[model samples]
Target: MDKTFTYQELQKYNGKDGNPAYVSYKGTVYDVTESDLWKNGRHQNLHDAGDDMSLLIDQAPHGVEVFERELVKEVGKLV
Candidate 1:
């Protein structure tokens, strides 16, 4: 498989209250953002996945948090 996200890019996307990166896993789109998951960090677990949503399950390296429309939040410190 081709590499999609990088450490630097992932950091910029996660761990920040901005545009969340979209990570395609198991042919499903997850609404990961700084609001719920860490802004620029990679979390591979049922905990960080917002109630084991399973919306992002696959062999792919931890999905990159993407900016979801419904997942809106203020640009501030990481709660």
Candidate 2:
């Protein structure tokens, strides 16, 4: 079963100070720490980790398929 994480709980994995970076999109949390783009918990200096990117993603030049294409690991779901 997938684990559930509240927004508050998710913040702890912000990929800062050796923490793992996690981001949410459409209620699903993805582990983006391994992606060089997400280094230090920031993406292209435009987005931050520990955030629900559902809205921001819509404005992105790419679609949600980037997640699948990149093979980003799904860590859990947002509550």
Candidate 3:
């Protein structure tokens, strides 16, 4: 079964200090820790992990293709 996370629980993986990085999109959480672009939990120095990025995608230079391209794996769901 898929794991579930509360907003506060999901906020723990912000990628700082070499911690695992995670981000939520459309209520699904993805493990972005292994991604080079997400070093230190920051994506392109603009976006950070541990939060919902669904609304931020439109502002990104690219589209949903970024997820497929990165092959980011879903880890859980936001409660």
Candidate 4:
């Protein structure tokens, strides 16, 4: 079954030790905890997990291509 998480619920998985870092982009939640770039739940030390990053994408040096290239997998949907 597909999982659906609220903003508050998603915040709990903030990439901390033993926590599953999850970030939302375009309404989709992705498990970024496994990526080295997201080690400790931080992406480039600029952004963290547990929040929607749709607007932030524009500020990124790269674009949506990072998602495909980094091999991040969607884990759920933000509700």
Candidate 5:
């Protein structure tokens, strides 16, 4: 399934904070808050949890708002 997300939507999460955005291939929940790359709107580094973020939403330029609006769907808050 295709999915996407925005920086704002990404912020409302915490790493492995006893919640998960997506069920991993290994049957694990990736805590968004655990990823350091998501800090301060800058993804300077790659982390394992990033893959989970992809399952929840696909990131695109702001102009792609039309597409991004439905990325998360029922997961987390509705876009």
Candidate 6:
């Protein structure tokens, strides 16, 4: 079953101090640790890891399809 994480719990995976980098979109959490674009838990110095990216995604140049691509892995769901 997919893991469920609360906003508070999601903060623990901030890709800092050896923790894995995770970001949420539309209630789903994605593992972005493997993406170079998300180096150091930061994306292009614009977005940070462990954040609900749902809102910011709309402002991005790309669309939600980016999440459907192999760029990131679905890890869990956000509550």
What is the Cα root-mean-square deviation between model 5 and the actual structure?
Answer: 11.5
Q: Give the C-alpha miss distance for residue 13 in model 1, angstroms.
A: 6.5
List ranges where model 3 is wrong by over 4 Å: none
Runs in model 2 lying further than 4 Å from the true structure: none
lDDT of each: 0.38, 0.89, 0.86, 0.85, 0.34, 0.90
Per-candidate TM equals 0.27, 0.92, 0.88, 0.90, 0.22, 0.93
Model 3 residue-pair collision total:
0
How displaced is residue 24 in candidate 1, in Å? 2.0
Mind giving the per-residue lDDT tens digits that candidate 1 earns over 20-50?
6433333233435534444443454323322
Top candidate by TM-score? 6
* TM-score, cand. 4 vs. native: 0.90
Residue by residue across 12-75, what tens digits does model 2's lDDT show?
Answer: 8898999999998888999999989899999989999988899999898889986874647998
RMSD of each: 10.6, 1.2, 1.4, 1.4, 11.5, 1.1
What clash pairs does model 5 have?
A: 3-57, 3-58, 4-57, 4-58, 14-33, 15-33, 15-34, 16-31
lDDT at 79, model 5: 32
Better of 1 and 4 by lDDT: 4
Give the C-alpha lDDT of model 1. Answer: 0.38
Quantify how close model 4 is to the true structure by its C-alpha RMSD in Å: 1.4
Off by over 4 Å in 4: none
Stretches of model 1 off by over 4 angstroms after superposition: 1-17, 44-79
**lDDT value, candidate 3, whole model:** 0.86
Tens digits of per-residue lDDT, candidate 4, 19-41, equal: 98888888888888778888888
lDDT of 5 by residue, 2-73 (tens): 243444444434334543333122222233333333453233443333243444334433332322333322
Error of 2 at 31 (Å): 0.2
Q: In model 5, which regions exceed 4 Å deviation? A: 21-79
